[model samples]
Target: MPRRTILIVEDERSLAEVLAYNLESEGHEVHVARDGRDGLSKARALLPDLIVLDLMLPVMDGLAVCRELRSDARTKGVRVLMLTAKGEEVDELVGFHMGADDYVTKPFKMKPLVARVRSLLRRPDAEEAEADKVSGAGLEVDRERHTATAGGEDLNLTPTEFRLLWTLMRQPGRPFSRHELMDASRGGDANALERTIDVHVRSLRQKLGDRAETVETVRGVGYRFNENAVAAD
Candidate 1:
């Protein structure tokens, strides 16, 4: 795997050090920020391939930092992996809504955390291998440009949401299990909960607006793009 740059934005010195050490050992260029303000500053300056962000911080919180990153054209494409306290499902879901790619609960295992980072770093290459663009039912995804649109309006999707839509659009009418969607939406080392896929799907549908019907939930299975929706339109 090629070496990549990663930024760790955590207020806890010990935790940041541990993460930096592990990431560096994996041959990544690692940078550490002790607070959200500094983290956002460094992220904009460095434009790292991925950021390991803590949800709580002094100065600015992680949610605010994430929002800023997604809003700034210079930093919006940088991948974010949120770190939250254990069992904070609300924060995890909120992080996703704010455009996080993946997350690990606090007191996480080192090995799993390292795997998640590796997965995130490998995603771009995978996405680039796909066709440059795909469109149907007024929905369009441009892989080369990393952009999505619906009904002639641009859709601001997080990386995960974009990938999920891309996968479904590619195989319209084919039902995908949550496990399958989960894998397709994330990188090779993705370790997200199955329900996480549901959350992303909900958000994706909301963004689709009236065109939301194009993405059909498969009930007991998972989800599928409605091939007929495109034909009817």
Candidate 2:
């Protein structure tokens, strides 16, 4: 496997070193930043394959850093795995809305976190075999081209959002449970982080603009793309 680049933005000296060590052991080239401001700077320069962001960062804070990353075109698509001491669902949602691809609470085991990091680094092209192009509700995604556009305008989606949209649009009108979508987006075991799917969908819909209605939530079920549009030919 190619050595992927990763940036660790953590304030805790010991925690940061531990994360860096474990990731380095995985054969990844890892860089560490001690504060949010520094972290953002490294992220822009490195544009690393993935970022392990700490929620409670100094100088800027994780949400702000994530927001900045998502807004910057150069780093917009980079995957982010947020870590925080808070396990509250609301905190996770806040992080997700800021464009975190995955969330891990504090006191997390290094083994599982490493596994999740591996999953986050997996690109869409490396996922389960699927069609090259999918079009629906005026949105188009081309896996081979690594692009998602609405009316020819770039969606500028983070990696996670793109995967969720592709998973939904690939099979229009099929109700996918939150767990299924989670697995499809992150490429790992289905986790209880189903609610995070809602955050991604919300972000996706906002980017979809007027076409937001394309993704309909099924009560007690999950979400599905409206079959109203034709698949790309």
Best by lDDT: 1
Q: Please, what is the TM-score per model?
A: 0.54, 0.54
lDDT of 2 at 35: 95
Candidate 2 displacement at residue 9 in angstroms: 0.1
Clashing pairs in 1: none
Against the true structure, candidate 2 has what lDDT? 0.80
Task: Report, for all candidates in order, the number of backbone clashes.
Answer: 0, 0
Runs in model 2 deviating more than 4 A are: 125-233
lDDT of each: 0.81, 0.80
Q: In model 1, which range of ten residues has the least summed lDDT? A: 182-191
lDDT string, candidate 2, 1-233, tens digits: 45666889999999988998899899876777789998887676445678999989889999999999999876788899999998998998988888999999988889999999988777564432334578876788986566999878899998778877877887778787776676556532224387888998999989988888788898998898995743332
